[model samples]
Target: MNATKYIILLLLLPLLFGCSNDGINNNNRYLPNYGFSVDINMELPLYTNLQFTGNPVYIDQAGVGITGIFVMNTGGGYVAYEATCPNQEISECSGMFLQGITAICPCDEAEYNLFNGQSTEKEFPLKQYRVEVVNPSVIRVFN
Candidate 1:
């Protein structure tokens, strides 16, 4: 009986370790679902920077919070992040700005990386959305 239990435990160990929230994080609190769409044209002057690698842009549309969306080109692909200050109440000062390669929160000054939404100063990472490249010229951002 003990041998059978040990075998079962060994088998279950791999499954338990595989089921992890490695890439996805739900650290943002007190946020409401405010879905929006953004269609970007790389040819346009406003979005021409996205054609280059490691360039981030701030879009002031989408989400129920004060901040909008922080979009960037990671060379591998495009990524979109919620510009709201994570783990804080939605308020006027909760919007974040794109400072170099990091998202700077106005209220608490928490910084998050635009590439992978990892927090630099705090434990909570910024919320992110799905980005789809419709074509070489067009990109869509949605949550």
Candidate 2:
């Protein structure tokens, strides 16, 4: 009788704590894993505008997904974001445009702050890449 009681308690321990699907159900796995490296030479004509603060540029490079990427200078540092709308399903209209310090999605008017990748109207923020300043005039964006 004692052995049976101990066995039942061991089996019931897991049920008492319960289980949650919160972490196991991460939805980001559904999103494609697109990775690329972009080197921005601020001295170049195409990226010269990025040398100044509050300026942004869009680049369509390989591995950047359907919308490419948006890079900006925030006066203090450089930031890069995937130019796709986080709220909408992947489509042609899901591309986002840089408007000052915000990235706007024309499809549904979804806005995301470039400074921190926070979406103003949605729970999921824009996907961001790692930016590294290789030198005074060069910056690298990578996944």
Report lDDT (CA) for all predictions: 0.79, 0.79
TM-score of 1: 0.76
Residues 1-143 of candidate 1 have per-residue lDDT tens digits of 99999999999999989775436555455666566777888888988989988899887854422467878999999988888887678888887888888988888877788888887567677887778899998999876
> What would the per-residue lDDT of candidate 2 be over residues 57-129, giving only the tens digit for each residue?
8888766654688899989988887888876678778778878888898998988888778875687777767
Best by lDDT: 1
> Where does candidate 2 stray beyond 4 Å?
1-30
Clashes of each: 0, 0
Candidate 2, poorest ten consecutive residues by summed lDDT: 21-30
Please, what is the TM-score per model?
Answer: 0.76, 0.74
Clashes of 1: 0
